[model samples]
Target: MRYSRSFIHTQYEVPKEAETPSHVLLLRGSYIYPAAAGIYSLLPLGHRVAEKIKKIIREEMDGIDGLEVTMPVLNPAELWKATKRYFDIGPELFRFRDRRQREFVLAMTHEEIVTDIAKKFLRSYRDLPVMLYQIQTKVRDEARPRAGLLRVREFQMKDGYSFHPDFEDLDRYYPRIYNAYLRIFARCGLNAVPIEADTGIMGGTGSHEFMLESAHGEDQFVVCTQCDYRANTEKAVGLKPAVKDLSANPPAMASVATPGVKTIGDLMEFFQTTEDHFLKTVAYDADGRLVLAVVRGDFNISVTKLANHLKAVHVDLASEDLLERHGLFGGFLSPVGLKDKNLRVVVDTSVGHETLYIAGGNAVDVHLKNVLPGRDFPVTEQVDIAEVRSGDTCAQCASGRLDVRRGIELGHTFKLGTKYTAPDTMDVTFLGADGANHRVVMGCYGIGVERLMASAVEQWHDEAGIIWPVTIAPYQVILSTLGKSPEVDDAADALYEALRTRWEVLYDDRDESPGVKLKDADLLGIPLRVVVSQRGLKKGTFEVKVRRTGEVFFFGRDEIEAAVARIVADLSPSLDGLPLLPEMG
Candidate 1:
């Protein structure tokens, strides 16, 4: 389709609010427009690109026999209440009231709605293994939606939820989506890494996140570029460098008086040793008053697991006032009957098994030395609070060292088991061969549509403009008609018509200079460009340019259609079945 002549001179400059590469080019190229924080109005150009990506997603999802269903965007809050997620999801959910004053929300996700539908209609084992899906808009109130379309509050998404009878069934479909995700990213011109995910807020034991590696990314990933291993550090499990029993040989923990020193740095400077040489103790408010938490000071708190230990909704460092109120020292807190309340205590997996170590006095500026763990401060239980970092041991690659990188979460899939099914959920059940009722298991897969577009630009663009993949480009070929003669326009318009039967063509039928047309073509970034100029027309030739590769070829008008058709045909066939899948058997 021909873009508005206005688009050529519209001065598609990047918006001032865009903070990331994708956000800049997307706004500059007229792909998307900001509507509100975390929300956007996808312009024609952006909408077309998003639809193409969604089509690819539909193809892959359908290929997996993913049954398509359109759930309501405004879900009743009761559905979430049934699944116990009404309050569990926290404030990200956009809750509101309808005309009748009934509570509702622009659906943050469809798990609860999908499962509720299943519970009523899906009874018996015959419906045991159903994979249902939908491509719709999910509304989430992101407190800070700064990265343009990358973190929008409301955007298109392809969310799928499946029901199964067993974990093996869930495991089998895991790779189906896994392999499909790889193809989706590859076709979108991205090298996304599949990482071990924590399944946060999603609340599942086994989960994975497809991430595009980039410094501008919001998620953290640990990758072994040497091999094929990668994971999100939030959920990454790897070998930790042994903090070798380097505890002052003879393992003697003695409090040395250096006078008025309190930090590990203070202790290190006085002892003239490295962080690796000392035992690190940190105090945290898990759920109640105060219990000392310890890690090798060198390691970080893997709060993901720590939260699970306290069985609490969330955890954070104690406030200064709370510290003083509890009679605990800020940096010197340790385990010594300071169990103020249900004072939940947690330690790193490394420190969880340590027999004895120095601790805090829980008061003024005193610290315990050579205090054995069980003998010093007794805790009700233990947990892993340290996050694994780079240069640490890699659990998967064994001998290989570990490292980390940041990325955005594009797609996530998890095995949900009975999380959605219960005795009250009579809508979900299967029949055994003996006719007994059996509970069906469940799984889910999701991809953010707008985020995928943003991720591509984040990874593919250069300073010129967006470098869109051929499969998703708004126009597969841009026909730039240059020179003052109308003959050039007629010739290119005819060629554009011929190509339109099988491809998308952007014909620049405007009275503009060759330089202007070319610059605009670069800015629009159609995968291919053809110049119908008077100079070339006189020579019985037209200039054909590959926008991505910038290779120009002078080809005769007579053979131009065939050449362009061949290039497009070669790129069209297989790219169609990917991104989205075909119906499953």
Candidate 2:
């Protein structure tokens, strides 16, 4: 492609609305244009990049015996209703009424619809263990979409679903998907880490999220330095260090008037004790039932873990009216006398049975000292619902400490055991060898095409512009003709014709200055750059430069292709030195 005839637009100034590095480079490079706050229109350059990503995904999925099929983005609300996601997913689902007043949805995902299709086709166990996938568009009503492609409302995704006759078959096939996910990211020139994740709203038993660590990421995960233990913070578990026994005799329980003291800092200043000695009681509305959760003063509750434990669809802080009606003070709440209201109580695993600690005295501006669980208060349930923090003991290897890092989720795979196939959800079933009907097990895998490209930009870019990986670059080589000499232009055009036979070359034949052309080349992030200039022609060689390493080589006119191949190999050395998977010979 010649830049003179191409609709390529590169800007000098950064976009004011851009927040992250990928957003800045994508907008300034004219790869994408924002249609709305959370929606974008992919330009020619971005479209080409997205197609390359899709090709990689298709190859990997095909290698795993996946059959590609296109699913409709506009699905009837009845499909979601079968799985109860129509009501459970809340406002994020894009719902509307059609001309006939029938409700429909712009699918956030295709699990329910895909499962229904499987039920209609696969009747007996002979038709089991089939994988179907699609590369399609998905839309969600994001409340505060930002960070460019990282948090978009409408985007392209490659979602795949697998159906099996038994749990064992699904479990055996899961590792193949796991290894395939790693290969897919690696082929895209990304080093993504897979971590244990919570199956939220997907109704799955287990899940894993492929993450690319970045400073401008939305998800937080912990990676163990000692072992292979890694998980998203929402699902991560850590050991609670055992505390030493107190040396002094226990003090008698008494109430103290704490006026104008509401926070933990106030209590610390008033009593002059460490934070661990205070018990923090948090009140929440778990599916509209009031529940009191108590933990150590230094720990914060993990709401994800709490919601999973309660098995509730929604959990939020208790409203003021709900608290007042339950005879619970705003700041002073305890389990001393609320046992009559059937309020649920969940204690943290860190709290000991005989440990005496300070707690709320059930009255405003009041607190109790020397309160002991199982003695002064009833202990019903204890769980590991506290948030995992830095330096916490690792749950897998009790010796190693935990550390947290931010990451962008590029892909996810879930082991959905009977969740989508049960009688309650779509009622998908098949006959077994014994002639008995059973629920089909399922698995879901997904990759965000645009976000994958954006994550590459985020991790690979430098101060100048984007540093696209060769696998997903719009073009492999960009040939530039510098200076006003027609001889240089003629030499560049000939080289472009020759290289186009073996590579995707972008011939910059535009009447632009050398400075502007070079800056745009960097912003576009093509791997290899070939320059045909009068100075180089006088030197009896062409000037070649590697975009990522800035390595320059003067090549003879006949040695251009060999030099380009060598540099491409040096940049990426996998599967015959090609960026994407090598074609089967």
Candidate 3:
């Protein structure tokens, strides 16, 4: 592709609307253009980078027996209705009407469509396992689209689904895809780690997300340095409490008068003790019903964990009316004297039995001191409600301190057992040796193509511009002629034409200063750059520089091609046991 005809416009200043560095540089470099608030146009340079990432994905997916296809952008509304997700996937989904006024939806995901296809084609155990994938655009009505390509309403992705005979088979295939994802990220110049993650909406038993570490990332995850235990905060495990025989040292339940005290802070100050000496109890309305939530005084509650417990789309602190209806005071709500039959009380393990603690007094501006669990108060359920902190002990190895990190999810894979292939629900089946039929287990994987690009920029940029990986730079080399002399122009033109067959060369034939041209070359982030200057002609030599390292060397005109070939050979990552950037037929 010739640079002049590529239709990608160049710019220098960052757009004021862009809030992040990746967004600013990406748009400024003409890699992408905003089509809408959350949508973008992948122009020539941007599209090539994305396509190169996609090719890496293709190679990895195919290594794991993946067969590619083009899935539909619009799926039948009935297919979703049957799966109960038509109404389940609410506002984020883009719903519309066809010409006949029948309701339809742009495909946010292809699980239902894939399941429907399998029901018709997969009949017996002989076809027990299958892997399928597609690279396509997905649309969603994002409430807020910010930070450029990192979070978009519409973008490109490679979504894959697989079917197997049993959970064991599903397990066997999960790791294969996980490793493939590692290779994909590695080839794309991303240093990522696989962290245990929530299966949300994908409806799977377990899942893992490959995360690229970035300060501008939206997801919060915890990584333990001692052991390889990493997990998204929403699904991260907590350290198990050391087994305490709370039955001994039992403290009896008794209420002490305390005025002008309601919250944990008030009680702590009134009692003249640290926060751990008290149990903080709060009430919330889960759906139409009331549930009591208790945690350690110093610990902050995790809303995600609380919502999961209630199995609710949303949960909020109980309103005064709901609390009064549940027979609790508005300002002073306690788990004691539990007379409300419909209300449920759940307490965190931190508020253990045999420990003297303080709680609400069930009356406004009052509190009860020396409250003990299983004695002064009887809780109905136990939970881990507190959020993990930076210095918290590791749950797995117990040696390293747990630390939080911000990361972008570049890839995700899951084992979905019978979630899609249940009988009459997509009804995908395979036959047994004994002539019996069974549902096929499933696995799904996803890669955020644009997110990967944004993360790459986050890691590989300098003060001037992006330092792109040679493995995936938009172009392999840039042919620049710095001076206005016709001889320099002839040398550059010759180099451009000669290098076309061997490389994707960009010729800076425009009248620009040597300094200006070099700055633009740095901004373009091409791997190898060659400048034809008048002085080089006198020495019968040309200047060659590596974009990643900014290492420059002089080479004879005839030897430049071989030097570039050697650099790409040594520096670019290997794919499929082959040299990097093997020319596509």
Candidate 4:
């Protein structure tokens, strides 16, 4: 590719809408152009990078005996309705009516369509296990899409699904996909950690997400200091210290006057006690129903865990009107003496049975003292809903403390079991050797192609620009002619011809200054940069600079090609030493 005829456009100033490093660099480098809020168009250089990433994904997926197949971008709404996802999912799942008045949907995922295909074929246990994958586009109506390709409503993805006869077969095959995912990321020059994650809209028994730790990430996770325990905060657990009994014999519940003291800090100061001595009751509206959640005052509630526990489609803080309609006070709310039969109350396990706590007095400007769990309020259900914090003890290792961190999800694998193939769901079945039919066990894996590309930029970039790995860079070498001398131009033209045959070369033959050409080379982030100038010609040598390290080397004209070949060979990332999975407790 020659600079004079290429479609590359770079800017000196960052765009106003750019938020993260990847977003700013990508837009300034002319790699991507925003068509809408959550939509983008990949330019020439960006398309080349995306194609390289897709090639790597194909090689890895094919290595694991995966059969490639292209699914549809539009699907019949009946397929989604068969799995009950059409109604379960909200606006994110794009739905519309065709001209014939038949309902259809834009594919957010291919699980339902794949299951429908499986039920038509694979009639016997002989075809027990098979891996099918596709590199296709997916659509989701994101409410807020930002950070370039990190979070987009429309993007390319490599989604794969596997079918097995029994749980044992699925369990045996799950590790292969996990290891492949690790190799894929490592080859892309990223060190992503696999952490246990929650199965959100995709109902499954277990799931793990590959995360690359970044300060600008949207997801928060925890890692053990002494062990290999890692999990997203929404699904993480911690070991709680046992609460000591405040008194030898618990005292009876009594009312206390707390005028104008509504907040936890105020109540703690009024009673001269710690935060754990009080009960914090929060009201929520889960699927249009009122729910009361109680936890120790020192802990905050995780809305993700609360919604998952209640199996609610949506959960948010209850409004004042909703609470008042249920006869529940905002600051003085309690689970005890509730008259509404439809109200649901859930308590966190941190509220111990023996510890006496100060709870709401069910009235304004008042509180109850010496309130017990089972004695004062009924123990209908108890679970862990407290958010994990830094310095908390690890639940698995018990001896290690957790360190909270932020990361971006690069890939995710789910052990779906029969969630989509059960009789009550998609009803995908196969005949077994025992002359009976059974639901096929399954697993799904996905990697966002654009997200991976952006994450690589996020993980490996400097003030100059993105430092692309050699394997996935748009071009391996950039040849620039520094001076207007005809001698330098002749030398650079010859070098471009000689290198283009053996390597991916981008020749800068434009009528631009040396400073502008050099800065553009660095901004493009080619692995090796070759310079031909009159000064260097006088020295009987050519200049070579490594973009990643900024190290310059001078080689004789005859040895320039060999030097570039060797450097490019060394720049490719290797995955020989990576483990299949990180250590786990």
Q: What's the lDDT for all of these models? A: 0.74, 0.88, 0.80, 0.91
TM-score of 4: 0.97
lDDT tens digits, residues 487-552, model 3?
998888888898888888778777767887888888878888888999998899999998888799
Model 4 deviation from native, Cα RMSD in Å: 2.0
What are the RMSD figures for all models against the true structure? Answer: 3.4, 2.9, 4.1, 2.0
Local error of candidate 2 at residue 289 (angstroms): 1.7
Deviation in angstroms for 42 in model 1? 0.7
Residues 15-113 of candidate 4 have per-residue lDDT tens digits of 999999999888888899999997999999899989989999999999988999999999999989888899989899899999998999999889998
The residue pairs in collision within model 3 are 124-430, 124-431, 125-430, 125-431
- Residue 80, candidate 2: alpha-carbon lDDT: 93
TM-score per candidate, chains pooled = 0.91, 0.97, 0.91, 0.97
lDDT, residue 108, candidate 2: 88
Q: After superposition, how far is residue 82 of candidate 2 from its true place, in Å?
A: 1.7
Instruction: Mark the 10 consecutive residues where model 1 has the least summed lDDT.
Output: 576-585
Cα lDDT tens digits, model 1, 362-419, are: 5566655555555455655655667778877777768776778888888998877777
Worst 10-residue stretch by lDDT in candidate 3?
576-585
Q: After superposition, how far is residue 134 of candidate 4 from its true place, in Å?
A: 0.7
Output the worst ten-in-a-row residue range by lDDT, candidate 2: 576-585
Clashing pairs in 4: none
